[model samples]
Target chain A: MWVIKRSGEREEYDENKVKQALLRSGASEAEADEILEKLRGRVYNGITTHEIYQHVRRMLDRKRKIRYSLKDAIFSLGPEGHFFESLVARLFQETGYAVRVRECIRGRCIPHEIDILAERGSERYLVECKFHNSAGTRCGIQTALYTYARFLDISEVMPFASPWLVTNTKFSGDVITYARCIGMRLLGWRFPEDGGLESLLESHKLYPITILAIKKDVRNSLLTNGIITIKEIFTKKDRIYDILPELKANEVLYAARAVAECL
Target chain B: MWVIKRSGEREEYDENKVKQALLRSGASEAEADEILEKLRGRVYNGITTHEIYQHVRRMLDRKRKIRYSLKDAIFSLGPEGHFFESLVARLFQETGYAVRVRECIRGRCIPHEIDILAERGSERYLVECKFHNSAGTRCGIQTALYTYARFLDISEVMPFASPWLVTNTKFSGDVITYARCIGMRLLGWRFPEDGGLESLLESHKLYPITILAIKKDVRNSLLTNGIITIKEIFTKKDRIYDILPELKANEVLYAARAVAECL
Candidate 1:
């Protein structure tokens, strides 16, 4: 079967590709085989990868295995910039810190708009979020160095505050080393092995709304309006309905509850 | 007499320096001599270069020679970013073009916020404003190249619109050559020699309020509220008064009139 990719390129579909993906997501050998067998029955001559992804997501959602496919949902949160900042801020807030997003703070040399500022008790964190919509991109040394320089300027005034750099994607080895050397906390999608962005989100039961199986434009509209987390969608359901009035009330509520169940 | 420099180094006050600056401004040798003689009585030990600048500015303001000193006034308009974009937008408006500031246009690859979009008759221009707060900085080839890429992405959609790069400071020779080769119009502090940013502002009798000698915080507050041009200050005088309630009414009105006189 021919499968269309996101970039509009066509490629031959392989059952092994599906099996491997399921296996990586912690599916047992028998479970992976059963899903592939079911998927094979629905194969067509020209099916989009997005269609296949939705099919798999639905199957996983039914089996309570959506947690394994949450990464793909996060990737849907694009074209990236401020939306990612909001996601990071929401994540921090979920962990019991008061968060401020896109704050313009005066540094010693120049003024900078910090992505996230989180405070818990006397401890404050000035976060620099580097978000990459494409999984192929990685945060590098240049980003770490620049963040460190800004931190140096800001630390003069707020010495008690610490600098933390977070990315939706992973960081390069050089960036990790430099950040470690400077004592700057570095978080990525999956870098610290035991505790990265995914692990933290899983720990806090905080999943971004982008992972919901809704229309892309609806997800983008919600993100644009600073609605990212499942909790936000639940709490601000009326606002979400107001922004996307065309979307049915039950549909929005169902999607929110569906994603919240996975979290 | 001692004079301080921008770098904070102190040097003996030289009459020749004053004469050279005035001569560069198109003052005749005799006129330069007369200005220097008048300035001699005001010289003092440990006097700052900024103090000397005020004396020279007063002399120029009196003689309507403020054109020569307008660059310094432009530099005063920052902790830079969006304020400079507003200034450029205002400049385009003064030149009889309908302008849009911070417009997000959809490009082929991604969305881009064009700093200024100027439309006049059948002509449309996509402008990128590179603002540098420090005098020592210059817009380089990287900026030119990156801007060219965005222009290419945008021009596919806006085929009629040409790309123009404007900077508060000058451009390096390499950047000028690259831009010229690509047919991208370039504007900078002293670029194109005859009609740079300074000349453009002077020709149109447009000057930003940063040169108004008000407290930096007040000027910043005004710029933050989208008040950049002298006309904006005059028209939005109440907004300025509201932002700066601590300042007496006469103080704001007097500063507005003082800057207006130069224009």
Candidate 2:
């Protein structure tokens, strides 16, 4: 049989092979076989790798078989973070963008945090997440103010770029009006225009970050131990598979390159 | 020239003479004169003794002319503690009900906590104030629960009494409906039915409690000197009024009789 993946690639489907792969990924033997049986009609030759991974992930999550460590990595939103990153991760996934939450901005002796950084094709967005009842001067006017500040800090050595502020709280009425007046694209939580809080993630079409992307991203990023910023992933001009494995094989080379370029 | 007194009562007109009276009450000569100037036509001969005292209180508040001790006392919300007291105080005053921010609850060991309790024409209302966000249960329902609980407590002694709940945050839709279903009145920071906060006070024609009332009540209850709680006031009503100089000696005897019977 053959299956078409989310990425529109075709893949050969072999029940035993799929079951073995799921087992290797920590699913129990019976669990893996059960997944294969459930996914029987969905498998096909030339199916995208992403589709295969998705099948395995959904199977595990449905069975409540997720590992604690794996769950933490999936949900982590960096230090002292709020729930906005979770919302962004969910929404971006629905928008067909590959999203990662709390990817570290690594280069120098000190590390930085990005709330979320997502990419689709060559397009990438660096996002800072904020949640507030009413926006205040410091955190309100520019939700991404901190991102820009971080950018300035790393611009000297890293190829620093691509940032946006994604907030659960809307900008102040005056600030929103002013932003529009000044031609700044303000995307945030607001009613009617964006479906308010109740329908926020639903309207964005991202209910949750799919588990496959989460597993693969965590595996690759931890392999090199060199921090991956969403910026680097977007700027690579290639699929994460191509870039991630190479960094995994040669951590020293990747780290050197990352440090040499100002991000 | 006539002057309104501290009790909200009108008195004989004598601009300089009333100024001297304010000075005798510890106001600076200049401030006393200034208060008297503000008091000019507000007074009329044969004005009630209570009205004369109220004029002084208003002048002091408007001009910020009271001694720091008295100022602190007025702002403290004596027996009604917490944000609810402040909200009720503001609401009651805004509604034109001669609102006393904190009325000392006429008891021993009740402590000084102002939770806005409004009184008009022999009808006394106790209000519990709450300020909450969308995250918690609605203030309306919560307040209604408290009202029921308080009513249960008081009903054991005197049956069929209800208290009101005032909140700074607006109620949730379902919570509001539920509150209405359960026969609870919901008040927001502003409501047209209440004639808005300020107009509510205007219509009620109520004034703040006079210092004399506070002093009289405090001494009668002897709250500052150590008596506290309604129970104590009831039990010790026999000698309560004699200790309070501000009360007419006869009124004290009558109040003691009332307290004993209520108990």
Candidate 3:
């Protein structure tokens, strides 16, 4: 049986591979064998790895309290997260820096639209945000060097500002090394020794609205209106029922409060 | 007095600036003063810096034995040097490497049209040729990084070949450093410490047709026919009169011989 990979390449399905994945995801050898047996009993020809992944996730979510649903919700923000850049801007704002999104500044040679420019006291940061919806994609060294070059050009005009590279996913090893060598600050999902985008978001009590158990259309509507965080949703809690009339006022407030607590 | 700069900015024309430039170009103080006096008498309003540079070059050319005219001929290749990539491929051919111009190879991720692929004695080189007619413009670090990334993609499939970036102009310092760090060989005009494009052409006895002292139309026709080097002209010397009935047989041969001597 051939299974389609994420990149659309079809390979012969191996039962051992599925069992190995199950075992890696905290299943015992016996449980892995049981899952493999269950999967083999069903039809498997011409199936996609995505379908298998979803089935595995559903199975694991039932047995574990790992909140895979919340993670999947975040993953669902993929194509609909129009306010992701604004969400990043809000995170910077919560961290005490006055943030501007999509600010155009004249460099020495050319004009550059910086994704986020944050200023706190004497420190100024010109940020280049790389928002990749897929976890497989990464911000590579080319992006890092390109942003650094832009920073160099802008620094000739605005010398006080430092360049910061912010990405929704992780940066490649080459990017990290080059950034370190050139003294560029990088913020990615799991980069840096101690802190990264996730830790920063958690510490600043900022949670994206995608994590909420609200309706997709309601979340998208709020995101379109520049409301991205749980804190933003909490502040406009009274109008939540008006925006999403299908949900009860108490339920909306309760979900907002629950998400805000996690933040 | 006002003068237009290359960036289209107008600045007050300083007499000392002209004099300083003249002095730097091996002119005596008296000669500099004489040139400044003559320039002052001419109508200088709304004159571009390019016009001023042309005037200075003309004056310098009159007094010097060095062939600045030949260099200007190379500059005249502007926009019409579509066959420059083919010319570079020819250079590799002269250097005993079997070359393929504009060979499209399927990389691991995307298809890349390598400008020149030179293979000789079990060694293959994937060369990216950047042809710029202007001397002032340079290939920067971004191009280097981009080429390196493409090489990385190609290497996943064709791992034996090396990546080489060849340009008709100089490379920026950052490009040099980055290329050195990444082990991508860069060849440009006056770039590497020892050998550059000019030195390479000289060593290999390959001179571009652009540097030949011939009529513009004839040069363009030859270039259009994929004849880029003096060596190619020499090979086709017997039919030169047939191609251009306007020119005498001796003139074409003379021009070809002169350029070949320079090589």
Cα lDDT tens digits, model 2, A1-263, are 66554435555655676665565446777776787778876756666655665666666743233321122232343323444465556566667788878877652322456677678887766666665432221235324333443443333446524555555445665445433432334456443364543244433322222212335554345324322333333334254445456544344344334432421
In terms of lDDT, which candidate is strongest?
Answer: 1
- List candidate 2 stretches off by more than 4 Å: A1-263, B1-75, B78-128, B131-165, B168-185, B188-263
Give the per-residue lDDT of model 3 (tens digit) for B131-187. 776666788766775677667667787964678998878888777766765577888
Q: Is the docking of candidate 3 incorrect, acceptable, medium or high quality?
A: incorrect
Runs in model 3 with CA error above 4 Å?
A1-3, A9-47, A60-82, A202-205, A213-216, A238-263, B1-263
What is the C-alpha lDDT profile of model 1 across B24-126, one tens digit per residue?
6767887778878888889898887778777876786343455566677777766667777888888889889999888998655446688989999999999
Q: Write the per-residue lDDT of candidate 1 for residues A51-133, one digit (tens) a residue.
A: 88667766763424556656766776666677778878888887789998999886554456788889999899999988776
lDDT of each: 0.75, 0.46, 0.70
lDDT of 2 at A190: 45
Using TM-score, rank the candidates from best to worst.
Answer: 1, 3, 2
Worst 10 residues of 2 chain A by lDDT: A205-214
Full-model lDDT, candidate 3: 0.70
Name the 10 consecutive residues with the lowest summed lDDT in model 3 chain B.
B61-70
lDDT of 2 at A101: 80
Between 1 and 2, whose TM-score is larger? 1
True contacts kept of each: 0.00, 0.00, 0.08
- In model 3, the Cα lDDT at residue B73 comes to 46
Write down the TM-score of every candidate.
0.47, 0.24, 0.47
